[model samples]
Structure formats: structure tokens, C-alpha cells
Target: MLKNPFLDVEFVPDLMWFIGQFDVYDREETKGAELAVYNPDDECDREKLIVKYGLDLKCLSYRHKFVLVRFLGEKLDDPNFDFQSLFEIGEDCAGSWPRGEWYNLQNPKGFLQDVYVNAKKVWKKDLEKAALEDPSTW
Candidate 1:
């Protein structure tokens, strides 16, 4: 039997996890709970596809990474993720795990659009491979 090219709805979390782990932070410097997570912090699930295949995850996390694979070949065929400004916080990881935030965008979802504009060139091969591989394989 042939398999579907789109991502299975159930795989959303894994795809998100493949990108990185997310956490909400309540910072006085920013209103509401600020979203944060370290990029490519695969400590939780490093044995997944990208790692097994030896492709670099790079600094491009969920935001930019999602574009090439289309949320694992399912979402953003039109490209509106419905996120905010999207800032890259935490200049220093301080040598800790899982780095920092996830979404936390106040600028506009379009900011990610700008990043996606060049995503294929940046993560073309790696994204394609990970998207095609079974997350449960590991």
C-alpha cells in the first residue's frame, strides 16, 4: 500500500518535538507569558530521524524549519502559522539544557514568512529526509 505524503495528524507533537521543546516563561520584561525554547535541543528525542541520519539540525528551529517540511508535509501549504513577532531570546544558553522559548512572537506571523522565504535553501535536504522518515522508527 502506498503511504500518504502529508503528515499524519497524530504526528504534530513529534514534529514539533523534532524541532525542539517548548516552555512558557513569565518575565517582567515582557507582558503575558513569554514563549521560549532552545534550538535543536533534542535532549528529549535525539534518537529521531535527523540524528540517526547525521544531518545537522542547525539554529533553525520550529519557526524556520517548519516551512521546508510543511509541518512534516501537512501544514502551511498557504503559510499562515498564526504566530506573533517571534524573537530569538537568550543570547547565552549558559551551558544548560533545552536552551530557551518556543513561539513567543509579538511582531506578527509574517516574520516567520520572511524566514521561510529562504528555508528550502537552508534546510532542503535535512528537512526532506526528516519529514519522510517515521518518527516512531527510533
Candidate 2:
């Protein structure tokens, strides 16, 4: 049912090594952590579809964030819903970069566990380090 044949494959590790950099911060934090934006367009071959829906290597490490973005951009083949769009969605769900509180995500409860919750789980250590280090003067 998909137009692009490549967007139907499974995502692998090589397609998700970008999240090793970002650290998730909670509310009330003065400073936030920096994330390495991985633009696969620069590193990998475009013609070859790594995942069925196109994976954003940048959000790979943050499982919840990555899944949420993928959910936001279901139409991976649509030119309007490509990686950049996913980045936008990620920013939307995860709040703006440099530690802004524009769209803070709520922790998931009930059956559907929120992606941000899981993402924080993966980046907790890094986020802790960033929080304790202080960001205003830096």
C-alpha cells in the first residue's frame, strides 16, 4: 500500500547512532543539553531506503522521541513530511532547542507510554550531567 518501495524496510543500528549525544532535561532545569543533529542526507545514500518509513538518525537514541516523530510524519515519502519535518515534530514534542518551555511534553500514563518518558530514560545520565554543570554563564 506504500508508494515508495524502500520505506517498507526495517530500521537498523547504522541508521540510529545519532542519539548518543543528547541529554534529556526535565522541567525546572536552568540549563538544557545539546543534541547532535544527524542529517542522514549528508552521510547516507538517499536512493536506498533504510527503513520503510525513513528513519531520522538524529533521534535514534531517544526511542520515545524517535517513535513519536515517526508517528507525526507517517508519510515518509511525502516531500513535505521528510526528515526536516520530523525534526520539526521532534522540536514540537520535545520543546524548542537551547532549553525553551514552549511545548513541554507530559509524562505518559495509562496504556500508551509517552515517547518523551522513554527518551528521558535513555538520556537521563547525560541530562543529569548537563543539569548539574550550570548553563547560564556557560
Candidate 3:
């Protein structure tokens, strides 16, 4: 019953993230599409973990609803997600949603890597407005 068509995957330890729903305009413009980085194991704070991943405050912005997730607890050597860039595009409470496609990048015999490496414009919604809103939804 989710609006987004992306699947959740944890390739590396402490790096659980979704490939779809990517709305970052540029690598530095990831503020609007960033999901929260949580420490379910109590090893580090959210901010600290984000920093370790080279994600800065400007790189992430919260949206309306939060996605529930936990970081993997292990180490992955150069586990190239094979996706230098990824994003999502859609809206909640909208009926005319686009056809959803669920894909697992890690799957063999898939073109996930080839597409992303040569992608020019990815479709993704900008959810920064939802994150910076006041506690009271005015």
C-alpha cells in the first residue's frame, strides 16, 4: 500500500537504503531526497553515521512521512552499489500514479548498473517541503 515503487535493500552492513524515490538534483543536491540514517544498534547517533557516509546536513532533507529502516551491522569492502546515483518520483494521496516497477540491483542478469551509469534525468519527487514544516501542520 505504499505510494513509492522502490524496494528496500541492504547491500552492506549499516547501509540499508532504497534505490528508488531518488530526487536528488545533483550529488550535492541530495537534501530533498535523503532518508534518515538511524542507529538501531546504538553504536552511533544519526548525525554521526550520516557524516561517516559523506552525507552532510545539506545533503538530506526530511519529507512528510518517515521510512522505517535499520542499518546493517557489518562491513562491506568496496561494495559498489553499482549505483553512483539513484532517485524516486511520485506523490502521496494521488491516484494517477505512474506504473510502478520494482527492481533489485543486486539481482544477476539485470541492467540496473548500465542504466544508472548512463542515466541523464531521473524522475523523483522533491520532498523537502515536508521535512522543514513546523510541528503544527498549518
TM-score to native of every candidate shown = 0.30, 0.22, 0.16
Candidate whose lDDT is highest? 1
Q: Write model 2 residue lDDT over 41-73, tens digit each, in one string.
A: 322321122231132334333333333344433
Model 2 clash tally, residue pairs: 4
For 15-102, candidate 3 gives per-residue lDDT tens digits of 2132223222343234422323332122243223333332322323232122212121111123654332232224442222112221
Question: Model 2: runs farther than 4 Å from truth?
Answer: 1-113
What is the alpha-carbon lDDT for the whole of candidate 2? 0.31
Off by over 4 Å in 3: 5-15, 18-47, 52-65, 69-138
Ranking by TM-score: 1, 2, 3
Clashing pairs in 2: 7-52, 8-52, 9-52, 64-115
Alpha carbon lDDT of each predicted model = 0.36, 0.31, 0.27
The TM-score, computed over Cα atoms with residue i paired to residue i, of candidate 1 is: 0.30
Question: lDDT tens digits, residues 1-138, model 1?
Answer: 112235433222223333233322333233212222223233333223233222234544433354435643443443654343223445563211222333333332333333343345456666676667655442
